[model samples]
Target: MEKHSTLAQPDTLASAHRTFATEIAALQALDARLDDSFEQAVAMMLACQGRVVVTGIGKSGHIAKKIAATLASTGTPAFFMHGAEAIHGDLGMLTRQDIVLALSYSGAAHELLTVLSVVRRLGARLIALTGHAQSELARNADLHLDAHVAQEACPLNLAPTASTTAALVLGDALAVACLEARGFSREDFARSHPGGALGRRLLTRVRDVMRQGEALPIVHLDTPVADALVEMSTKGMGMTIVIDDNKQPAGIFTDGDLRRLIARHGDIRPLTVATGMTPGPKTIAPDALAVEAATVMDAGRLNQMLVVDDTGLLLGALHMHDLLAAKVI
Candidate 1:
């Protein structure tokens, strides 16, 4: 039992090391072989006015699905097709305007090749990522990328190993190139993934979430300290705007101001709203993004701020608590 336990862990570690080494060597070979064909593949994808169809067999098929997803999420439309299914009715998914990306470590996966005739008939541009340029898939493809590796990490040198890693990296290269070509932006990505927290953080606008109009806790610049305190308490936002007769924001009265004035004067009534008000308060536009408002608040070192219209008229108020409760932070 002792010998068996000792042998098992070391065997697993050795197999892992061999696998990593083989995959690294395969990526190195693929890196060395990058040439104009890669450029042509990107150009073919860029020219496609339709989706990109990714296909493979076995482990390659799993990798192909991931590649397809990445492409779709990053501004390029893409879908995965099982190579064997293409021989069935799935070939109908392909259109002349689309581009086909084929994957095969040996460059001769039979299931993948079964659709070569249909690919030509569909007139879809073909780009092959393979380990052998002379293989049937490469020979038939309109563009070919070399995915060669010196050896497999397997004891028998038969596992997919390095070849699959090389294929995946090459696929990533294609996706990123197309992503940049299309000028994909964070906003675009957010639209593709609106359900995630990141999407809300980036895409949610201030107008969508900010308090507005009469909901704002506001006091006129002429308001007495007692009345201003009433505004703050009733609004429950911890602060209130003090506006001039023209309805433009003249100052802001906060809980901090009330505390300081009481400590100094010992009488809240004798201090008018203007006396306790801060002359210049940080402000935001109602149309700004919620994340941007959070950034502005943090940068100014304040917990609460006033929201205004583009022409400087007071529109609403926001507190750091609003952001925290909305999970914008």
Candidate 2:
């Protein structure tokens, strides 16, 4: 039993190595398969006036969904339709202006054949991604992409393994190629993925989310500590900015400073903000990304920050909660 247990570990490791090796070889084969056909596919998608509808069945269906999402999020407008559902009225989603990209490893899923015929009759172009170029799905399509692999990673060679990986990588290749051909920018990607963290990092500017104007807790340097506390309380930012006569930041007093003041003196109400303010506080510009502001606050162990202009004048305020609300954190 102990000998068998010891051998099992090496057996599992060998299986993993074999799986990786097979998939890598399959991808290499796929890379070599890329030629003018790949370029033609990309050009067709680039010139598409409507969405690219991706459809497949079973495991291929999952990959189809992901490819559709990748295309949509990267500037190519696309959505997934189930191959099985196409005959059940989901075919209404296809139009003459649209292009259908169908995935079927066998090149002949009965469900896909029926859907492909209907899509063709609807005047939509078809791009077939299949392992068999001689198969019906590939033969009826306007474009055929051979996503064939030599063998499965499965030890039995019965499961869809390396073939699926090759199909997925090919889908990614098509999406990225189309993305580059269209000259899609990061901002364009952010627009499509507005609910994600990448969108927040790319699109959310400090000034767009900062509290400014009357919301600023600005007090003169000569303001008493008690009055500064009132301004901070009214603004609800846990801090107050002390401005010089030229409307520039002279110093800043925060809840931390108040705590130190209370610990050092029994009566801090009589002292001016100048006596307790921290001089030359860190500031950020309005045009900076909110994620950048979050980075500054985190590096300094700060909970709040002040926004400023080029001449050292205070413009607005930023709190950690603001970054949180903006999803920039």
Candidate 3:
């Protein structure tokens, strides 16, 4: 095969370092520029009776969409409307009760300006994120957030690198501030993100994953140790629960206990499960979060836990493997 010489590569690592430095400086400047306008913006969004509509174009539009998603997931109702699409017909998504968050690095994008005009006509509020304070969009907005940057990370100083980073961080700040103001809890966040790992950890209860009904390995206290071992093997839980007449867990016998019992005494054939079981094993409420169950099991170095009700009646059992299967671990 004919070979062609490759072009010499530039100092890519140095370029990346320079980009990081530039963006960090831009963020510091944006942080220092934060003032009453930011406070008012948060208050306005919190007071909004309708959704927050974020709109922008080009690179700014991507940032706007992310901001809208973050706000919606963090206890605020928000959505993105493309600037050009809004001018054509998507503006109907907005209502007088809604607040428009418009982004344009130059503060002079024509499509954003058109959306701004319609926003005013509809009696909706407008918040502008732009690099220029004196620009038309900034001047006309009900609130303006300055996302100015000294220079782009691009060596030519023309691309939207530093400016976009500043805008994105500013948007995150707004979302988090609103989230805190609304007192959004972990459960609330889990509700919005039901398909995510955090949702499984926060929203799933012990009852949702614990083994119950025929899957439980139950043996009476008077049962033979060999019988308890059979129940444990049949249930595949590595342990058997010793239950009383009231179906309350009296004790638990694990494989470890069986091993220790054998080591302590050579004659095991005459013993009942009571001689080898661990009494008053750790238990948790069925309604407790699965992650909480995991914490308790981890703290005690236990593999199995009994789920009970207020009256201490055994409802089910939870193996560490169950949490792993449910992805709550």
Candidate 4:
């Protein structure tokens, strides 16, 4: 349990809210400044045949890592390189075809500049995100984005706050611009992320894992009730497809149907498969994505789905457990 302190508030509390609003306002202003340089940065990345190498120092390094992740997820291959490590042995990660995106609030990070000469000699183009256009980093960069801010969120006006926000917004702007110009599709995005919820929604198709052939627990509509139960138990899918003499699905019989029949009629051996079966069970298309199948299954228990073509001929059946095991959910 927390000991609630009943302390009187100071006048500075109101000023703190004002500070947050002010920083947010700075971000809005920076959003409006997203222009050609943002497009140029995207173009530079699109033209590169090699990976994008991102480098920064201090708090800017954290922002740089996030920007790199956004780029990688959006179809641009990118990775962050520590500024100091580049002086050690990580500079070998850079190729001449790659582009360097450097971040420094003051447009000058001592460690980032350590390899500036080598990067230039290797003919790699530089795109810098910084506040000072005249600072060393900006002057040396091939393209510079102006992420200037009038004040910091800190009361002392020294800590990086509005500046960091501006840089983050600018990085997002660049990545999205590139994402659009490259015609990055949802399928492509899913290909890069086969682990995320969005990826599961886009990539997993039904045919990829649906149970087909003899694996489907099925029986003729006129098959004995005793035989149908045996088939369902053998397949372990909790249901069986009811097909007619023409080999077309007539209906379905599930554990629920059996329970209801036992409750209503109290049958011992008089009923047959057609007597208690549910005709025209819910079905799904083979081309449907696993995500869509999940939705159908979620609507109810949907133990199994009958896959069919346009003409409605039975193709196969799929189980909800199959989808779960495949990690399609």
Judged by TM-score, which candidate is best? 3
Query: Relative to the true structure, how large is the alpha-carbon lDDT of every model?
Result: 0.85, 0.91, 0.95, 0.85
- Can you list the residue pairs that collide in candidate 4? none
Scanning candidate 2 in windows of ten residues, the lowest lDDT window is 1-10
lDDT order of candidates, top first: 3, 2, 4, 1
Per-residue alpha-carbon lDDT of candidate 2 for residues 1-329, written as tens digits (9 for 90 to 100): 45544543457888899999999999999898788888888988999999999999998999999999999988899999999898788998899999999999999999899988888788889999999999999999999999999999998998899998999999999999999888999889888888888988999999989999998899999999999999999999999989988889888899999998888887897899988889888899999999999999999998888898887768898999999998888
Q: Which parts of model 4 are misplaced by more than 4 Å?
A: 1-15, 32-35, 213-215, 245-248, 259-270, 296-303, 309-315, 320-329
Worst 10-residue lDDT window for candidate 4 reads 264-273
What's the best-to-worst order under TM-score?
3, 1, 4, 2
- Which portions of model 2 miss their true places by more than 4 Å? 1-10, 212-215, 233-236, 243-250, 255-269, 275-283, 296-303, 308-315, 324-327
lDDT of 4 by residue, 93-210 (tens): 8988888899998987887777676789898878888899898988998888889888888878898888888888888877888899889999999899898877877888888878
